[model samples]
Target chain A: MATEEAAGGLAFHPMDQFLVRPLFGGTEIHWYTPTNVTLWMGLTVLAIVFVLVIGSRGRAIVPSRMQSVAELTFGMVHKMLEDITGKDGLKYFPYVMTLFCFIVFANFLGLLPTAFATTSHIAVTAVLAVMVFLGVTILGFVKNGAHFLGLFWVSSAPLALRPVLAVIEIISYFVRPVSHSIRLAGNVMAGHAVIKVFAGFAALAAIAPVSILAITAMYGLEVLVALIQAYVFTILTCVYLKDALHPGH
Target chain B: MATTTQEAAGHAADAANAMLPGTDAHGSAVGMPQLVFETFPNQIFWLLVTLVVIYFVLSRIALPRIGGVLADRAGKISNDIATAEELKLKAKEAEASYLRALADAKAEAGRIIAAARAEIQADLDAATARADAEIAAKTAESEVRINEIRAGALEAVNVVARDTAAEIVAAFGARADAGAIEAAVAARVKG
Candidate 1:
């Protein structure tokens, strides 16, 4: 460690990798600024179009490779929506599909070298989670009318415990979005930061081999985490949607 | 590790310094870049735009097109199956008619054989009847001829016996009258 510091110090700037810099040279990050966020988000949108729009453009009876992938993604989300929220939930297909496609593409795209993971940011995931939270709550109220409050009211609990259980249920219900957003961002950020930390150790010749091995392993896990996080986020939305539709239990 | 890396990055940035956005004046991240308040607006705006675009693209164009394709494929498959089934029915009908024609031909052959047999049987019966009638008429004629011959032979024998009786009466020398002898012969013949 002493020798490494004496060797003009190790160049360890892991957090700099996440710096949201302007694509065109300027320091001011306005709301409309064309930053790396815009570039990555735009790429994410293009990736979605490639898969969903162009992939299924053939409309072949026997599907092409891209077409089948498109169909598989569509069917998987559709089935999840049906399983959780039943037939009426299919009306929200476009909304649900949008979230799924955006998250999945952003996540996978972020795995590339020097790519910014838009989904790893709290500002981003929180927006999606809060949207889902508000949408579900509103949908619950609209669908079930006054009966939507039954979600927190535990009718099945013993008379003495009902109020206490209701309070707990209310707390947990409100905590959904917080946990939801943090779970994705935290998972993604933690994996990336870990890999970066390992990258820092690669500066020393003695530790380079082991450090690279650790980075490799973490990278593999991150790949899995990327897809799984997308799936987890979308499925959770479906579950919340189900709750909104059927608030009795 | 965080402080050490931050210090090192700080020094490095200082040497070749230009403070990047989302970093401190020393070019190290203030904390986590994710916590940077300034970039939130940029990320949120872009994300909203992306989501809205994706939603519109999918609902308006992608989804409906994919769904239409699926439905079209299904409908086409069923239509093909129906056509195949109709052809199969037609084939079956053709086979049945073929079998019916085969049976009719066999029935016709049987009818022809029966008619031929009946005609042969009738001709054989006619020939047999004609042969039997000819044999019966020949036998009747032969019997009539035999009866006539017998009658003629019986008259000759009667004439010889009358002549012999006359000669015997003359040889006895007490000659009875020829008319008396003839009367005796006639009485004997009558008795």
Candidate 2:
């Protein structure tokens, strides 16, 4: 079966080109440039513009339908941030909310059959991670200034071993962004690859009922993974933003 | 050193062959799958732009408008309630004033009627007193004239008695007593 042939890599994989872009003369783009990311960004801009224009037009005390929806979404995100970061965590509301909306929409866009999962790629995930890392780091300095550097040291450790503990803590603190980025990319990529494998198996199977059931089950699981991955990305973002605002905990 | 370099080269070749687009030793090309990172510059640019746009909108426009609408609604409701309360108080005050005016008017009307009745009674009493005094003076004058007429009639009656006594004395062979006859006639008149 072609499915088996493709799975075994005996056949040239069409989707394999969806990786790092090969720069041609430094200016031209490569085949692996993810269109999915562009589509998601376009959709997000449209959504934001639509909400802003329509939701605030009348601004009545009794909210119109659009305004009500806008308010509800805001309240939901605000409450979620408060729950994750506690009451004083409201300062990070804008950052966390933006991250959640962007990631959730991006993940959903990636689930389409022809769409590329940009978040599944290390490059894209790394870019997002770097932004979070930079933001949190800068915020820590802005909020706490010099004291923020103390987060790298376990000051409560025994005086004799405090130096060693501080070094370890600093290394661990530096590792947070890498781990956070890799976890999202790895999970999304692994899930999509597994689903592709299962689908290939069902396509090659001679029996109809068994293969159909297997594909159905895998499809359902893929949907669940999509939702879970989005949630994981959003929750981690909240955690990181919180750390920036309150470094001690 | 030559053997070690050859071994390293061989290892590198093996790793390359395994990553090739062909079946691996396990006959599963899925094994040692090469997941790469390929993000379009345009997409990255757009995504960042979208985020910034959304953040600006949420902070500046939507939230403030929603809050303003709510505050305006609350203020309008409170003002309406306050106005209604004030109007109710004004109505109560007006009703009190109206009732007071009505009572005062009734009291004034009663006083006017009492004064009118007193004036009418005084005028009627004055007219009655004048009529009674005039009637008493006329009666006194009538009684005095009646006394004067009776005295005149008594004198005439005495003269008539003297003439009639003189005729009786000449007709009979005896003289009549005029003074005793006059005294008897006056006593009969008195009785």
Candidate 3:
């Protein structure tokens, strides 16, 4: 906030854009109240529908550009799902693909100027991670019953150290959802914040060019990070799903 | 040293206000709203709705269409390859049968050639044998005619010699009888 008033007496509120104000101009945000977050999230869904549903409506064998993009995204995620979880994992392909498409769309949409990054918040990511964690855990129990507990037991370790290892394993296991959620939120937040700080520096004539340059560089990196983060999140989900289906050493 | 001291003072101020809920040097409701926790429920609710809608769209519509195109391509390629393999097998069988027929034809041709040569050889042998028989018969007949001519000439010569002998006796005027002259001429010729 000091940086806001540091240059030319103009207050540059970089974090101000992240504020969740009601779209209807009300001060308070109720459960049913629509906010900028809702607008952007809705836009994200519309964007997905446009590209995936309406774009490939013709379903030409030799696809148009939009259809090609849709099929490419579909095949990429399909192959990733198949590769990580094998054929049986394809049963949950739609759910995993939904998570991937949503996160990626939200991330890329956030990259637009003055756009709100819903994925940058812990609340959004925590829900996704917890859902995956709970789903996999329940699946493990259903598929393997009592053997699902074997994931925590260090059967390969020495008998003396097995208990110690189990405790550590259990702690890490519980930490999975926390780490998963925080990793995505932290990376997205850091990139956007860095860009905002650079943009704030752009108010000064002396450093305006340098700040713009830095913002451009950071934007490029953020673009790559957005895609990579989405991929990482999906693949990790697949790995956890694999463990649930087959919970051995 | 002066800059470091001022930085320390700034850090102290930040630490003091950091504990206060949603208030910092940026004033109330001015910090990162992502940390505010007020907007979370709304964001989470929308995210859920969006994700559920996307899942249905993909599973119900988009995925099945793309899957159909892929399966159709795979089916076409495999069918074409299978047809090619079948044609290749047929071509190999035809070539094999052609080679078999050629070999059979060659053997039949050789048999025909050998049979023709043998027949020609037999005809040549019969012709030579017939010509040899004809020459031998002609030579035997010629030898018999020569012997007959020689006997005829020898008889003529004996009669001439007896007539001349009687004429010479008659010129000497001896007056010899026919039976006595003949007996004398025969005894002289015999001697």
Candidate 4:
């Protein structure tokens, strides 16, 4: 590709440097590296802080409209936690609710053209997945001690097959993090890539009109996918958290 | 027939692939390395940090506050309702007592009027009996006085008759027999 073409936004690729690049040498820092994650995380944090500050400011006998909204959101999340985990599930509500809000906002932020979809990268998603995996696992062990290991074998299993059953259970348990991470990453990556490809057609002069329409439709679909992915990720985390808190049941 | 369509799609895909040298149909593998970076570690770190923070905030702050507020609200509402109900019951009892008192007052007033009437009737009956007795005594005395006056008038008439008989006998030159005279005087006296 010519320099002129490059300057004119001619792609080596449309999603070329999704990763952050270092400003000084690679040793110092990279701009494109986790560019989306940083921005999203910042935005999410700011939004949460703003909500909390404004929401809690007017602790009145009767809530102001903003407080009411905050209350409504809290109530909704509380009810959801109560529903999923039963009453005992309430102890973990804050963690689950905050996780939900943060992820949802982060995912929504990625929809912007200039923004990075951090979750689209397997590395980022996998890291998040592993944390949940490890945290829940540790919590389980700490809470139930060696009894948590019994999650592998059905207490009612036939005596002869208990060992074999334990192996399968262990394998399945180990695969949990992998499946969880890949599910989120694959969905986000696939949706974004598909949108990018459709968008590429709009660049060509001959197919501009049809390509624009198709890309527009795909963009709309991608937005829905973004929200769904966020919801799926959050709910799955709740499930894992549940398993950890109470291993068998 | 399905195979034919698949083959046609495959042919179209092949043509497209020929047109674009380095593109996956899914467009995911383009410009990406064969050895993908291991995402496990990074995902684990961020998620763990987020979970811990959220857990702490919820357990320590958010949930406690919300729970407290909800409990407070519930307590206030129940208290208010209980107070209202108690007041209503008190009002009902007070109203019932007021009505009962009114009814008793009316009954007492009625009884008082009845008692007063009985007392007035008794006094009137006593007065009437005394007056009747006094009238009877006066009537008896008047009758005795009338009998005395009648007796006096008859005595006077008797005296006059005796003198008149003696005179008339002397005037007629008739010999006045002593036994006859005596008999006539005795008759007058008896009359």
Taking the tens digit of each residue's C-alpha lDDT, what string does model 4 give over A1-249?
A: 111134335343444424432223221122233323455555565555556544655665577776676666577677766666678767667666776666665666667776766667676667667777998899889988998888887778899998999999899989998998788777776666676666766676887798788878878887888777777777777777777767774
Among incorrect, acceptable, medium and high, the docking class of model 4 is incorrect
lDDT accuracy of residue B48 in candidate 2? 69
- Candidate 3 per-residue lDDT over residues B1-191, each given as its tens digit: 34433443454356644322243545433557776655566677777887788888888987787777666667877988999999999999999999999999999999999999999989988888888888778777777777777776655655665566667778887766777766666676668
| Candidate 2 structure quality by residue, lDDT tens digits, A25-112 | 2212223333445555566556655765467678767778887766666676777778877887787676666666556555666666
lDDT of 3 by residue, A97-214 (tens): 8989899999999999989998988888999999999999999999999999999998999999989999999999899999999999989988988898799788789999999999
Candidate 1 per-residue lDDT over residues B17-123, each given as its tens digit: 55554566555665678887767877888999999999999999988988787788889999999999999999999999999999999999999999999999899
lDDT of 3: 0.81
Candidate 1 per-residue lDDT, tens place, A1-249, comes to 111223446756666667788899866666787999999999999999999999998889999999999988988988898998999999999999999999889988988878988888999999999999999999999999999998888889899998999899999999999999999888888888788778878888899999999999999999999989889999999999999998877
Q: Which one wins on DockQ?
A: 1
TM-score of each: 0.78, 0.56, 0.75, 0.67
User: Candidate 4 residues B20-99, lDDT tens each?
Assistant: 11224543234542122322233334445544654565556655665566567778899999999999999999999999
State the weakest 10-residue window (summed lDDT) of model 4 chain B: B33-42
Per-model DockQ: 0.39, 0.14, 0.22, 0.09
Candidate 4 local lDDT, residue A57: 59
Position A172, candidate 1: lDDT: 97
Off by over 4 Å in 1: A1-8, B1-21, B77-127, B130-191
Name the runs in model 2 displaced over 4 angstroms: A1-34, A58-62, A78-97, A107-126, A149-249, B1-35, B38-46, B56-182, B189-191
